[model samples]
Target chain A: MTRIAVDAMSGDHGAPVAVEAVMASLRAHPDLEIIVVGDADALNKEIARHRKADVGDRLTVQHAAEVVGMCESPARSLRQKKDSSMRVSINLVQQGSASACVSAGNTGALMATARFVLKTLAGIDRPAIVSPIPSRRGHTLMLDLGANAECTPEQLFQFAVMGAVLAEAVHSVDSPRVGLLNIGAEEMKGNVQIQQAGKLIGDSELNYIGFVEGDDIYIGDVDVVVCDGFVGNVALKTSEGLGKLIAQFLREEFSRNALTRTAALFAMPVLRAFRRRVDPRQYNGATFIGLQGTVIKSHGDADAVAFASAIDVARMEVEQQVPERIRTLLAHSLGE
Target chain B: MTRIAVDAMSGDHGAPVAVEAVMASLRAHPDLEIIVVGDADALNKEIARHRKADVGDRLTVQHAAEVVGMCESPARSLRQKKDSSMRVSINLVQQGSASACVSAGNTGALMATARFVLKTLAGIDRPAIVSPIPSRRGHTLMLDLGANAECTPEQLFQFAVMGAVLAEAVHSVDSPRVGLLNIGAEEMKGNVQIQQAGKLIGDSELNYIGFVEGDDIYIGDVDVVVCDGFVGNVALKTSEGLGKLIAQFLREEFSRNALTRTAALFAMPVLRAFRRRVDPRQYNGATFIGLQGTVIKSHGDADAVAFASAIDVARMEVEQQVPERIRTLLAHSLGE
Candidate 1:
């Protein structure tokens, strides 16, 4: 039985949502166990509610004296809230009490806490935030979503290797094709940073495809796309925004008049199907890779189902020993 | 009467589409005059087709012996293709033969030619690529789509002023709210460069709205969004890719089965309305700001209607003397 620690005091709604997700996931997956780490009183009440709802003893509670606020500074919060839920949850993984940890907390705080507690894998200087985005050919794994804002050419090369390893370890791409995110597909395009990174990756023995443009991320043939944190964050956020805008446009246009509304009624199935395929909620889970242990970050506002998705990703990552695989690959590639 | 030059020999299909857009825009606007620049014999044939369509003689042709190929290096092409249609069109703008020029040609070549021919406005160093993206509040103007890969804090400030002026001049936002694009909205967040830039803009006389994340670009509360070329290019390209992916998903979903096809029949009106609002073609024009003369770059794959939108944007910029306004404002802002 694999147990993953959950940061119950994280996110907007906090304990109830994460606790409920644990109960729901436990019911669905008999092999899974979740240790809820938060205020004992608050988590107990949510646990009681799940118990009354017929959830089993697979859900357990662990006390956390403090909770990191969303607006708190990551470094200061780390010092002030030593036993915060986020810190405690990551500590469980550090102590080998849990296979992994999932948190929907302040990203900066979470990254700082996890890094300090778990330490980094050998040969890995800093970890990366890797997530899957749905595309034409299936999923394209993108890394450095908001980890290190400025990455050297060597660091970007490391991210490519780690992303490819993650894709191969979990997503099962035999020779995961990697690409450098750039302004244009041509060799001479992009700034000095990207141009240098592209050259390094192109020389590497890994399945390093040359330059890939922003459009290539969704074009979906490539397996892994690596970028610096700034560019990655912008690309990810813009995609999320555009997705919502498109959905809103469809809803508004469908309700324009009685004729369209009536058609919307009949067309609900097709529209729903379309929405389901492209729904952002289904793509909620993001992994903090290159760390010593698995740490999954769910959206701060994720509901039970989305939280469950994050837990599922945690289970997958832990089972595959993604971090260990990355460490091995990095050591081999860097000859350390 | 305002005269605009069109690069008829550019893009995938070449002269015919640009020529047709001129005919359409001419019929729509009584005061607009368009000069189509391309190979004389080929352009004359396209003009003849429009003539047969009963479009007016407001359309004229200028013969050019050469064309800059899409894949040619901007610098090498600038030297070799002096008589290329792209060069000829911008030359017209420089000589006061046309108020502005619109091209659906190779972007690098267009920007290089425009810079070489029109030169930079006083107090401005490098030009930026600014374009309008439809948003919840109507439209938001975003700058540095892929102009300069890396921008200093000072350069970003310059872009902010120019974008604010454009918003005030063309978009008619009296106190246009400007936002600096970053990974997070908080002041303490982002790298040193953005942090420094944020402080500068906040202290400026313009209506700076602090920091905005990637998602905020689509939310559209800010009238203008400023970013470095690298990040902006990624955001723009990612947005474009996601849009195509969503559209493709909808088409595939709607045509999945017989039941979905019937639903599609009833939902056609709403779907069409939704398509129109988010259509890339509807938002075709991209202005090369910081230049002494107005230069618009149309999408390489733009159709007649899309090309017409670019023409409209060019007309607006030329009529408002956007370049002169930016020059004066830059000079004033710099105390030069």
Candidate 2:
């Protein structure tokens, strides 16, 4: 049976949401077992709300004494909160009690704790966050979303490899096209490190397309795009802001007069379909790749559906043996 | 009359679009006179298509023998193509024959030629591209869109000053709130240079706010957002990509079936208003601030209405004396 550990108290809505998500996830996947780590009292109380006969041995609770705040310092959380739900959940993976872990916690704290506990894969230097961004054709997998703020050329090359492997395993794309994100498409464009990284990637066995600009991410021609964490983070957040702004503008326009309101009722189904097709919730989980074990991060404010999606991502990575695949791929490509 | 120089051959659409834009701009503002600089044969033919009575001395042609291709090397264009239309237009600004210069050309060539001809203002180290991005409420002025790829902490500070001054002069806001764009809003979040730049901006007298994240740009709280050119360029281009993707998605949804098509008919007026409000063309002009003379960069693919908006931006900047304001603001703040 595949088992996963979840940080039940890390999200904005605490253990109740986690319990609800766990119950739903267990029903969806019969062979899956979930251990929700948090204050035992809170978790049990919420678990009691569900049908006890349905849960059986599939659902359980693990006690944790502390919780990490969303805005807490990563270093402080790692040093002080040894028994926190976020730390305990990752610990379950290290102990081999759980095949993978999912958390809706402070991202910095989670990354730091995961790296310290599970360590990097044999051929990898740093673990990078790889997530899929919805695009026109399908979706593009992008790496180093916010892990290494500043990266060496070699680190960027490493990210490209990990992204390609994950895309192959999860999305089932044969020989995914990997792209280095830059300001322009020209070979001479971008910062010095990016230029050097381009040469390295171009020399690799991975299907390396040349540099891609920011607009190319949504244009959806390339399959995987890699960049330093800072640029990726800004790009991701900027897209989120634009999405919100457009939604706000649409609402204002549709509510301007009674006639427009009538249009909204007629257009509701199409709009709903459009929203579902492009909903960020569908792309909720960000996998911390290159780690020795599987760990997925949900948005800190994720609802039950979004948290369940993160759990599903963790389950799939475990089934596909993503870390083992990454290790083997790196070994073959780099002769490490 | 405020005479402006137009590089009539620079844009993708070339001289015809420039002539059309100039005629419209002149009609909109009677006090404006424009010199269309390009090949005499082509420009005159296009200008002849307009009514001769409307062509009074306000619209005239200045022959420039050569035109710089969009893909031409900026350094090579500066060194070899001295008589290029883009170069000659900036030279007109330098020679005091034109109050401002506007071009929809290769951005690199425009910046290189404008800096070489006009020179940066006293006490300003680098000229930045400042443009307004539509936000939830109104818009935010962001600087260093792609001018300086790698910037020192001092250059970022300089960008904040320039952005604030432009916000005051063009948007007419008193003491604009200038924000340093970082990955996170915390005090110790970004890379070394960004952290150092945050300190410099925080110490300044110009209504300095703390660091703003990428989402803050469209949240419409801050007035001026300063960032390195690489980050700023990625953010701007990413927003553009998202906009196009959403438009494409909306088109697909509306054309899916007969019911959706009928819904689109009912939603047409509201959708049109929504598109108009967030249209990128309305915010086309990016002022090359910190230069000694006014130079506006329009999108290379701009249509007549968009190009006319760029000329209007140049006229407003000339009237408000943006460069002089930035120079004075910097001299007072930096004691340079």
Candidate 3:
């Protein structure tokens, strides 16, 4: 049986929606056990909506007195709100009561609590926030989504290695091809950090494909892309913005005239397929890798379906023993 | 009469296309005079292709011995390629032979030669690359596109001032709103540099709107978006890539079947309008602001139409006296 800890008090929607999603997911997977960490009264009220009698055997509630605000500093929250639900969920992973933890709370708080409670994996300096990027060919995993704002060349090289291992383990790709995100394809095109990372990647044993520009992110030319959190966050948000703008423009275009409305009926199938291909929910969760245990972050606005998909991703990561495989791989090449 | 220096040998298509575009632009505006800078031999051959014989009176070729390669380092080229067309173009502007210099060669080389030849205006440490970004709403001018890689908070503040003055001169907007590009909209959201820049922008005399995120670039909420060259380059390229990807996807979607093809035929007018609105050529030419003289960079792949548009933009910048206005604005703000 797989046990997962859900941070019931976190997210924009708070514990109600998170509890409902977990219950729905539980209905689909009968063997799974969920540990809800949050205020006892709120958890009981939400669980009662699903009828505690139906899920009482599969659901367990852990009480926490404090909550971490979305705007609170991560370090301050970690030091002050020791009994917060975010901290409690991470503690479950550290105590080995859960295989993984899932949260939609303050990203910085979760990262800090995870690092302090669960600890970083051996030989890992800073963990990366890795996400599955939907591409033209298929899906590609990218790292440093929002974990480290600044990174050294060695840190980026480590992210490439860790991201490659995660992609191979979760997606079952053999020797995942890695690419360094840069302004240009030339080895000498980027800043001092990218230049140094390029040299390190070229000298490493991983299957490092040469540099890739931002345009290549969706081109599906490579399996993994590595960069610092600052560039990665901007890139991720830019892509999201573009997707929204394009969708909005198409919708407006389709509604502009009677002929377009009639033509939209004929093109609904293709449009629907295109929409699914770029749907944010289809690629919902981002894995917080390089920690001692698995932690997945679902989008704050994610529905039941998206949260369930995140749970599925976490299960795969744990089942594959990705951390051990990465340890072995890095030991051989990185001399850990 | 407005005089412009054109680097006839620059751009991907070379001299003939550039000459053709310049001639076409001249025909549209009878008051404009153009000095075509290139090898005298190549200029005469391309010049003969134009059927209008009297165009010779409005245009003349200046001899230059060398052309800079697109990949050549800007600093090295400035030191070695003294007789290059780019250098000669800047020399013409400095010597008051022309109001502005427009080139389609290597961006770094053009900027470096312009700065070295014309020097920065008083109280300006580094020049910034400014471009007019086409948003959902009309348009907004963004600065530091690729001029300075690393910037201090003070330099960013200066960019805001220069950008506002240029927008006022060219777009005829009074007190254009300036925004700092950051990951979030909150006051305390960005890195140390952004935090300091935010304070400076608030304290400065310009209409400094607080922090703006990546998504805001397309929303057209603010008139001027400011950031370091590294972030600006990433944002610009990412947007360019998305534009191309959307165009390709639209083409594929339209060609999926005969029914959709007929629908595409009916939607052509609306689609074409959308394309025109987002077309990069419509906003060609980025001005290297803050130098003593104006230098604009057209795209490397600029065709006749795009090159002509760049020339028009150059004309607008020159006629509005953007450089002199920026100098006055900065000198007043800094009390220098």
Q: Which has the greatest lDDT?
A: 2
- Arranged by lDDT with the best first, the candidates are 2, 1, 3
The DockQ figures for the candidates are: 0.67, 0.64, 0.38
TM-score of decoy 2: 0.98
Count of clashes in candidate 2: 0
The residue-by-residue lDDT of candidate 3 on B1-336, one tens digit each, is 889999888768879878988899899888889998989899888888887665648898988889988888887888999898888888999999998989998887888788889999888888998998776676778878767767899999989988898879988888898999876412234368878998988887789998777777777788998988776777777677767766777788778888778867766776776676667888888888898878888898998898998888888888898888887877777656
Interface RMSD of 1: 2.4
Worst 10 residues of 3 chain A by lDDT: A182-191
A-chain TM-score, model 3: 0.93
Model 3 stretches astray by more than 4 angstroms: A27-31, A39-57, A185-190, B51-56, B185-190
- CAPRI tier of model 1: medium
Candidate 1 chain A, poorest ten consecutive residues by summed lDDT: A182-191
In model 1, pairs of residues that clash are none
List runs of model 2 lying over 4 Å from the truth: A185-190, B185-190
Cand. 2: chain B TM-score: 0.97
Enumerate the chain B TM-scores of all models.
Answer: 0.95, 0.97, 0.95
State the RMSD for candidate 1: 2.0
Tens-digit lDDT track for model 3 on A2-115? 898988888788887788888876877777888989999999888887866666588899999988888888878989999999999999999999989898887888888898
